[model samples]
Target chain A: MDKVTEEELIGRSIKGDRRAQKSIYDALSPKMFSLCLRYTGDRAVAEDILQDGFITLFGRLDSYAGKGSFEGWARKIFVNTALMYLRKTDALKLSGDIEDARSLDNGEPPPGQQIGYKELLKMITSLEPSSRTVFNMHVIEGYSHKEIADSLGITEATSRSKLQRARLKLQDMIRKRN
Target chain B: MEDFENRFDLEVRSLMENAEEDVPSRIWDGVSSALDRKKAPVPAAVWWKRAAFAVAAAAAAAAAVFLVPRSTPDNTPTPGAPMVRTEVPVTAAPALLSEAVPSRPIIVAAAPAPAPAVVAAETAPQEMPSPETTETTVTKKDTKDQGQTAKVPLSFNKALFNKESRPKDIGRISISAGGNLQSNGSPAKMLTGFRYARAKAPAKAGITEVSESTYGMTLSAGIGVRYNFNPKWSIGTGVTYSLLSRSFTATYYDTSSPDLSVTGKTDNFQHYIGIPLNVYYNVISRNAIKFYVWGGGSVEKGVANKFILHDSSRDIRLTERIPGVQWSAGGGLGVEFAVAPNFGIYLDPGWRYYFNCAQPNSIRTQQPFTMNFEIGIRAGF
Candidate 1:
């Protein structure tokens, strides 16, 4: 959609026009679903998060002042909704010792270039829940360790440790697949 | 090793940057159903127009009632008859003698001797005549014995001498208390659509669950003053205080862990102070009873609004002061029973419609239209 049409759609959606809301949802839901899936491995849980994100988006749509990209603004809501779900489920409670991540490194060369996108996503989802969350926040979303820690209510060191463990686990899986 | 780590992170980020997965169609259906259950926003202008229309209609109706001519007994003397003072005897008729035995001077229209007498003016009667006796019969001898007045039967219309007179411009101060006859349920459910949305959640997922809602009794009390412009029409204004409350419990079950659930209970209380202006039309008036129909509008401001939420984790209490005024208009029937000459008690059973305002969730906002009953004592001067 053109910028003008997108702005109009947003205006109408804020006013509770159902067609406008559906249009926005159709445009945003796919990417948002993928984001939810990356944060929550289960398809059913991701679907629940997706529904809640859209609801929160429409509820707080009035706060969007067109200062930033509308897509970015909407993405934040979906991310927050996923995070809220994680917190409520206590999915971010890290287990095991941080030193355990170093043992899995194995000094192996990266096999990322040979892996397909689907295989890579599968490997990422296969990581433990807390580690996967930390990895997604720090690597894919460009959040700093401190930001991830603050968001997940964990220490910065713990966020870094989870990310390292997640990366080692993913590399190990990728090497086995190759 | 560091280069390998950098390459792995870069590859993962690039692959996931534009990742898009097809969303199941049922998620949109759930969202659509949830939006449908949400309360539609009411523009402030529309409610203002409605309230203005109500107040205007009420004023116009009251004006129409006041403008119509009232039927009163014609007490003016016959057009051409000259008024004369004379003494009339009450001895011939026993009823007249018992009523007015002592002859007193009265003004009567002069006519030929022995002609029927026309009473122009007489002393105010102590007792009112019976309805059946429209005209009092005075024998000719009653006047003949005096010889000073015409020897005509003293005839008069009893209604002209009615002892009980209709009061005008009566003022009344009243104190009233009443409650809503119907329950408005929980305002949180009405405002947030939380329960409805949770109900529409996928059954297999079993993502959301809510408990039954409990609502507190809605109550109101006020002190008012009314001024009767005439015997039939009057206007009233008063300050009223209202209290509304509701509570509900909600429990959400996690899809991944069915055994784990979060439960929360919410309680809401709202207090409003209102000023109402009403117009009343008396439909019936008998010995000491009156029936009236009234219509008017009111503007209320929320003085205090509080929401309390209790969950397994923590308790949250929030107080929000809504800035905008709440508008409402309605009409109902009322009856007043006079306990004394100047003191009466009244009952007003009426239906009221509350207009949506900027105020947060409350019973008034949840159920805009409600039936209320009010009882109070009124002192008239």
Candidate 2:
């Protein structure tokens, strides 16, 4: 949607126009659900987070001062919702270092063996919760180590180590699949 | 190794950042229902219209009461001592004369012209008259004794003539209890200093999120005394106790060795003792029912203000004294059913608005206008 139409939709949604709310929902739910699934790795939990994110979005819609991209602002809400869930479930509790999966990470994928999106998503989701959170925040979401540390309430070193471990695990899973 | 890691991250981001998946339809249903729940409270405009209708209805009732004429019965004479006149027939003149005149002989004055028979009874002393003190004058129009007039002293039973025009002195003592229904659309406005603390804490401790405050139900109970000045109006004053409550959630980040965020929930309760003064106007009073409209104001002092915080690890409680009085004004209609002559049950539904009292944040401060329904029993002596 264009900026003016999007602003009008938001205005109507804030005033509790259900049709406008449904329009915004229909436009944003799929992408937001995908983000939730990437963070949660469970479809049910992802749906829950999606619902909560939309609720929080509508509740605090007035705070959205048309500053940056509306999509970006909405994306942050979904991200925060997912993070809140993970924190509530204690899924972000980082344990001591895991056994290095470096030995299993064979050099590279065989020639002509390309990993598709579903397979890569499966591989990422198969990782442990803490590593998956760190990987999603750092790699996919483009969060720096300090930002991830501050967001997840961990030290920069722990965030970096979790990211490294997650990457090795994904590499191993891809190598095995190939 | 770093270059390889960077390449892998870039490839994953490219695949995942724009990922979209179909959402189940049930999620939309849930969102729709939640929105409806949030929108359940009657809008401010609708409430104002309702209030206007109520006021108009009360005014109409008052007008009806004033415009209708009241008829006094013949047997029940008007109160206070007054000269009463009655026509006596010639056939009954001898019996009335024999009964009314004491030992003194009736003095008869004869007139030449024929006239209608008339008897006038005069009672002395503006106060109630004794039987012996009342005087009666009798005139007889008989063909045989034309225009015969006689002065006779009459005796009246004090009880038969002592009827009051106004209502008797009535004082009522009542106990009442009720709950207020408040609109949930408005969130409690936090105290400025408390909100500042929360805002500053998040920055200092790297805490990011705080949820909105939600208010709970309010309850009140009280005892009152009302004095009826007349049949149409009464004034009442009472002491009441009220409890108001609300809660919110805040996420706190500990910047220590094992950095972690804790979500804490806080519930605030405020207790108040108040005195209300109201004036009631009776619009309709029939055999067993009385309908009235009352308007009043109250002043409340906060007695206890407490906060309880609960987190995953532990709970913390704090209490602070809030100074200043909360002032509120309201009006409503009441219907009272008298079970006995001196005892009655009443229901009053009213609207009230609380004024800002320079106190800490609370539900009253957030949604100051509310509707109240009270039911009680009153006893009059």
Candidate 3:
């Protein structure tokens, strides 16, 4: 089988070539699925968001400029799709952690216990949807607090408070596990 | 604190950066099917067809009003004054004439050259007597032949006055109670937030069928005053208390928890107190049955509402104070049996479409149209 280049595949898909569209889906679906799952925390919802993201991407395929990585552009679409699903369900509303703020500023790691990648992912899932998104974008995805606030349609103070609460909650969970 | 934060960030990135889950093969099929549906957009032809149907329905209703035989009189009835016209043949028996005219039917003027003398008879009396008494005592003797003009005080001719009316000749009031079944137009699309993945059932199996959605019954009770303007036309106004209720099962997937869904059997109840203004025309008046058509509008205030969601977790109850007032315009046909001259049993079947939305933000808000069918007894003076 001949290997089709990304540009040629995009051009073919734009022309309604089913084979090329399938090729694009095969190459990109796994990574996008992971991103959706992180945001949704449920397999069915994640899959739904993934399919919706792809539908939107294909519909607006003509709008994509060749200025950035195609994968980066696709990732942005999946993130937005997940956010919309959360908003419709009111999952992005802030939790009551602000009023229940207890000190969780432990300076040192728990003795003789190390957090594994699976445990870390579990911790992220346990946070509220709004707090989880803030934590992911600011701490892992390299978005500034201003950028997070702007994207989520919340104030910078709200974004900051959510992230602080997420960190405290994660630390409390880790200390208890240790 | 900085060291701890860096360690936590590193763990998150390492777990999330290259994480991948298997893409379900069925998803491709779903996507392709959705794409196919989008490609074939529903045309505007269906809309045009619906409009044509609605216009035809409206035209039929209008034709019915004009074609039906009308026997209602032309004068509005005054509470203390009896002024009505009867359309009985001059050669009719005096006893039959007395049976037809419950109020004092008198000839006010002589017949013109081209027209027969029109006798005005107020059918409803101030305080109506029993059918046996009314039949036995009413006489067709001319009021003027007795040397008493139309100005002869009702007190002087008390027995001549229809007993259905009060002694002073005030008109009559009728009260009724009935039940109705209403459709809310269409069910709203479900907004299930999330659903846990489950094993797929066989394609032909009907395991996923939800419960049947059904229309609900509403109850109404009212008291009204009917004033006969003429033999063929009458106008009425009344206050009614209506209790409207609808129950349905709504299924929603829980967003906060994975693999959790709830089926809510919700019962919504609303109370409205309304004043209705209506005009009725007598189409057929036989020995004991009177068939008429009435069209009216009601101004209603929502007094209270209750929403109960019974689910697997726990029942949630909400009491809402309905905001704003609503009004509806509707008409229907009615048949009344004169069990007695002043007491009758009536069956009224009508359609009432609300002019404004009721109970906004609630399930009761949709389908502002209702089909009302009521059967009750009427007592009038």
Candidate 4:
């Protein structure tokens, strides 16, 4: 077989060449799988999201006009796929549009950045689904309040308020750890 | 809002960027099986121009055979979906447009392009007046997308049978997207891989020396072109990205005394967005099976030679960057099935090795070598 170039491989994948499809799957599986895992926090669920996302990738590969970065395009697909799965699983309570937790005057402890990023994520995951989801979408995924509102079908103001509450809860969690 | 949010965003962004999840092992097996499975048939997008011509002629036949004259307004569904098909410019055949594609939707000749040719497919409503409409759109999608999906066909002889005398165009692009293996049952290899065989691992170690993971997943997209030097050999180059993060759990041994096992990992998430210039010496093919050898170099960033130390508490990370240009060489073996003259699919199991990332003055350098393996397929002009 001819030694294929990245453009050629992606082009063939877009063209629906079955082998090209597999080639794409092989090339991108690790990162996409990891991304799915991050959103779902479970491997089996992540795999489900990965499979569904790839199909979406192939089905709609035609729309990719070589405009934005292809990685960015694929990243959007995986993240959206995970979010979709999350929605189907949890009626998307965060969908009610909440962003922040009203601030509470919680005192701080001696700080040496005592927590690792992984430990912090674990703590975030422990929060109630409502708060965790909002914190994740806004604070972690970087979605705007209005964008969250559109996605979850809630008011933008509600999204903001929910985010505030999530932050307060997260702060409490961090305090308990200390 | 922007002020506090930006500060908050900065903290979260840094954390997310370094955040590595302790994922279950099954995730690897699941994704691998998915990738290893046979690629799905996407309505079988064949050689578009060829398929288009075939479909265009067939569509003409269907139109002629099924033509119903201007019937009552009730007979023609009101506000029906406009049949959309676009013109394909063929300099040789100026009149082909009228025969191949109608000027526009039968009524809205002067109206807007029904939908962008690309998006018009999925977003297209299914309740349109005719089932034949679906076929027309499918045929159009197949034909008009030549520029979008360029599969680098490996068969130069196939190119020889072409009707034209011009050399093959180098516009074809091939991309490899996903799939990776954490380990291939290479237990000894896994334990003693050339990365760091003798170095003191994380600041903590346990009795059993647990293994974290040697996992890598990537989201890569790049384009390349080939110049057919002859019927057998060609030179090609393109850029690709590799977002790889692999980890391993090691028990720390502070002077051989016992410490509990803690997971320590190294994440080498590199964006290998560089040019790969290569020369291919294709093994002669009999029918379906063929092989080729390729050699090249990578000009990339974020790719590194490093030893990251996660503190005993896993609290802080100190990075030691040993940077250099990585020379790479690899070869391939594969088989191709001819699905269409302008298109075909081939699977090549490829292996590659990288030099120059070997730690200098480190006695264990040669024992801990790193390389990459990939099997990809391409289809195009």
Q: DockQ (C-alpha) of model 3?
A: 0.13
User: How would you encode candidate 1's per-residue C-alpha lDDT over A1-178 as one tens digit per residue?
Assistant: 5789889999999888999999999999988899999989889999998997787677667656787688877776677677767766877676866663563435665677777777788788888889998898778877788766655667888888888898988877877777
Tens digits of per-residue lDDT for model 4, A1-178:
1234656877886665767776777666666765665566666777777775676566556656566566666766666666555654663565444434555443343221556666666666556555555566777656677666655556777767776776666655666778
Per-residue lDDT of candidate 1, residues B1-381 (tens digit) = 667677788888888867899999999997886666556434545544544554455445533433333344323333344334343322122323335644433323222212112233332232222222224333232343343323222332322122333453355444444433332432343223322112212111222213234556567787887877777788889888888776654333343532223345656677889999999998865434566899999998888776565653465465667688899998887776555445566777666888877565555665576556567777666
Top TM-score model: 1
> How high is each candidate's TM-score?
0.56, 0.52, 0.43, 0.34
Could you give candidate 1's fraction of true interface contacts?
A: 0.51
Which sections of candidate 3 miss by over 4 Å? A1-4, A96-118, A171-178, B1-4, B43-52, B71-381
* Residue B319 lDDT, candidate 1, scale 0-100: 66
Worst 10 residues of 3 chain B by lDDT: B200-209
Relative to the true structure, how large is the alpha-carbon lDDT of every model?
A: 0.63, 0.64, 0.57, 0.44
Query: What digit string (tens of lDDT, one per residue) describes model 2 on residues B1-381?
Result: 666677778888888888889999999997786667553434667666655665566456644543333342122233454534332322232334445435333333221112111223222212233332433334433343343333432212221111321244344444444433433322233121121111111122222334446666566788888878777788998888888776665444344622233455667788999999999988766434567899999999999887665654466465778788999999888877545445566777688888977766565665567666566777667
* Residue A35 lDDT (model 3): 80
Superposed Cα deviation of residue A69, candidate 4 (Å): 2.6
Model 2, residue A1: C-alpha shift (Å): 3.1
Sorted into a CAPRI-style docking class, model 4 comes out as incorrect
The regions of model 4 sitting more than 4 angstroms off are A1-6, A16-30, A94-100, A104-114, B1-5, B17-381
User: What 10-residue stretch in candidate 1 chain B is worst by lDDT?
Assistant: B195-204
